[model samples]
Target: SVEGSTGLIASLFNGIKVTQSTMSEVMALIDSSNTKLEYSSQELSNASKKLSESSNLQAVSLEETAAAIEEIASTIKQSSANAQKMTTHAQSVTKANEVGKNLAHQTVKSMDELSNEVNSILEAITVIDQIAFQTNILSLNAAVEAATAGEAGKGFAVVAAEVRNLATRSADAAKEIKAIVESATQKANMSKEVTDKMLQGYNALDDNINQTIGLIEEVANATKEQQNAIVQINDTVNSLDKATQENASLASNISVMAQNTQELVEQLKNAVSNTTYNELSKKRICDPALIFTANKLKSDHIVFKDNNFNNCGIGKNFTVKTHNECDLGKWINAHKNEKFAQTQAWNELLKVHEDVHAKVQKTVDLYAVGASNEEIFTYTKDVEQSATKVFALLDKLREINCENKS
Candidate 1:
């Protein structure tokens, strides 16, 4: 009976050891899970931050593109209006040219009629010359008859001489008038040639003007189409800008949720660490909440950095909390009497934490005053450096805490 009892007792001890070992392994798994969750949350926060930044940039670019398209549309509209005006002017010119062409035709007809009248005058002048020649011949016959009749024919001879003189003067006047008429006919022919050339030139100019009007009309039509297309493009750009802004808002929310999840995971890790079954496990499970808080702070700062101080969750009205008002600072204050607080890492952390807040306040002030992005970026670097130091110091504090707990 004693031997059986000893074996049962030994079996009971073996069972307890196994259970303790399983619990330790479970704790280790939980710790690993917590680490993985923290890492995954951080990665998600970073990704979402980048998405928000890209979306914002896309929105800005789309807005600028929309503005440019609007300007182009306006320019096209003006050009279209000008083209229409030109087309109207060209049409008016075409009408004027037609009127001029008509007038030119009338003038050409009048010149032709004048040439015909001049030709008729030349024929009449020839008839008058023949009559003068016949009269002169009749007068010579009378003179001859008078000479044959002696004294009685003397007075008739004088009247025949006077009639011959009158016929001769008529012939000279007819020749002078013919010369003037011939000169007038040559001038009329030249004028007709010039008018005909002018009429041809007018026709050619009319054709060219008509062609130009057609080209201008085509240009006007094309400009109108381009203006319509630009209007559509501007509408599309505005829609894209709206969508991008929505996307940015969504990304910002996602990043905030990811950070919240990370914080929750840290809390869960802390809760699990408190359930350790051994001193060694207790030492391994030091307070890492400050470390997680530092990580969150860094992630938040990254959001602001990535967003270029525009539309980040924090606004210009955001109050820049002092180090004492921050989570890590509060933790530090609560743990001031602790052994780790007296360490060099704690001192450095305090200094860097204050610097981080100072830089943040400066950034906010710059943003409030409408400072340039370059100026903000310069201060952002300072914040980044201080935040990095704070995180490193927090990690160091965590290590010191583990040692102190051990």
Candidate 2:
């Protein structure tokens, strides 16, 4: 009877175990249905938000495209006007060149006549020099004769000597006049050469002007071509503007699609969150302690300081180095090449050095005018801290940017 009771109890325990397993299976199915419903709702909400942002971006793009088309139109009009003005100026330059060439030719002819006159004067002066040479010889002979004839011939010799002296004076005057004539002749010749060269240059310039006029004509043709090209560009930009509008519309559609995808993913995420498996996955996916440690490592201590740079002209009543003779010396010696060394020295010593010193003196005076040291120190500290924070922020931003890129 005891053995029979034990068998009945075992059968009852097996039935209870089967009933508990069936109930667990039913609960899993209900949870899965709930997850699917939640995911669908979330996906719809995300899709709506994305569509709104995409629409706004498309509107902005359309406006920008229209503005760009208008700008192109204005540029084309301005370019056409400038091209016309250039063409007119080129024509005027051609006419002016022709007139200049004519004037240069007339100037050359006048210079040739002047040169002929100078040559004639030089020939007469040469003849005078030859006569003066003969006179000098005759004067020396008279002086000798006056010495040979003594006493009674002395009076007559004195007259001869006086005549000789008169001749000598005439010869000297002739020589001076010859020198002046030669100088004038040389100058005239030089002038003639210069004018002739100028005439040649003018002729060359005329030829070049003609060639340049041809080039200008070509440029005018090119300008017309450019004008036509600009017109085509305007048309192309208009077309591109229309295309951009279309692209924006397409982008809007793509954005909507992407939003819907995001929403679906979000729903899936929510659905997964509700599962025990998801909870285990989240713990495995991220370590909060590691994240906190990284954040702390990235943080920096910021400090500020401000001072009146009475000597440097940088800020308030800070006694900056007014005369940095050492800096000047260093700057002077900084140049490797000897030629640039002096220049570097002057640049450093004469330019900013003086100005900075002036500024420093001004700052000191400003601080002396009823400003307390504590107040000045506080201000200076504030300024320094502000600069430090700005640099720190910049560094942090760069790190974040680098991380994003990676």
Candidate 3:
């Protein structure tokens, strides 16, 4: 009976030792879990912060894009209106050309008629000259007959001499009139030639003006289409901005939830440290939020690239934030005096961040100067690469923090 009782007590002692070993192991696991939870919570907080910032930035970008689209639409409308006005003016010019051409035709007809009349006058003058010549010959014959009659025909001889003088004067007058008519006919022919050439010029000008009117009409139609496209783009941007704002709100909520979870974890850890064995509160750890800022930055760059390629809208007047103006930049500034700032990783991050902004600025300048898309894209890629390096450096800094904490 004594041996059985000793065996029972030893067995109970072994069971107690095993139970204490299990509790120690459980406590060690709790400590490790608390550490991991703390780290995870910090990471979650940071991710949430980045997401909120990204959402805000996206909203701003969308708003600015909408404003730019509106401005472009307005400009297009103005261009359309100007094109319409030009078309109207061209049409008016064409009408004036037609009127001038008609008047030219009428003037040419009148000139031809005048030339014909001058020719008829020349014919009449020739007939008058013949009459004068015949009259002079008749006068000469009459004078010779009268002289033959001597003194009896002396009075007749005087009358024939006077008639001969009148015939000679009439012939001289007819020659002078024919000279004047021929000079006028020559001038009329030259004027007619000039009028015909002027009419031809008017025809050529009319054809060119009509072509110009057609081109202006085409421009007006294209401008109208551009305006419509811009309006649609503006609407799309507004809608996207609204969604971004909602996402920002959701991020804020998630941040709050993460903080709450962290607090609950702290309480659980404290409770576990106090009790040897008790019901551990089951704490729910939420999934980590995505780091949206990096992706959003990349997306912004892509949009800028597309704008550069398309050569439209805000692309013409693209503007970028300075490194110090971004959320990450501000965070870096806030932590400048921290231990991580003394590390090479932090310095590299700073350099890479600045390089990213510099590259973006360079691309924007290139776009402004109408650089080729390939050139601009090269710079854009540099910016994206720099941005990626900056993030990697940031992760290195976080790792440094974790090592220091350990």
Q: lDDT, candidate 2, residue 325?
A: 42
Q: Which digits, one per residue and each the tens of the lDDT, describe model 3 over residues 361-396?
A: 787788677788787667766655564466456545
Query: Tens digits of per-residue lDDT for model 2 on 1-406?
Result: 1222211232233233333323332333334544655565456545555655665565576567657756765765676566567667766876786787677677677767776776787677677667766766776776677677767667767777676777667767777876886787677678767877876776787677677767756766775676677667667756765665665566556656656665665666576456443221122112233222222222211100112342323233344444344243243345334332234333433444345344434436546665666654454444333323333332233233334344
Question: What lDDT is reached at residue 391 by model 3?
Answer: 45
Give each model's clash number. Answer: 0, 15, 0
Query: After superposing candidate 1, which stretches have Cα over 4 Å from the reference?
Result: 1-29, 275-406
Candidate 3 achieves a global lDDT of 0.72
Kindly list the per-residue Cα lDDT of model 1 for residues 233-331, writing each as its tens digit.
887887888889889999989999998999899898888878875434333335545434544554544443334344323335566657797666777
TM-score of 2: 0.36
TM-scores of the models, in the order given: 0.61, 0.36, 0.59
Question: Of the candidates shown, which would achieve the greatest TM-score relative to the real structure?
Answer: 1
Q: Which 10-residue window in model 3 sums to the lowest lDDT?
A: 281-290
Candidate 2 vs candidate 3: the lDDT winner is 3
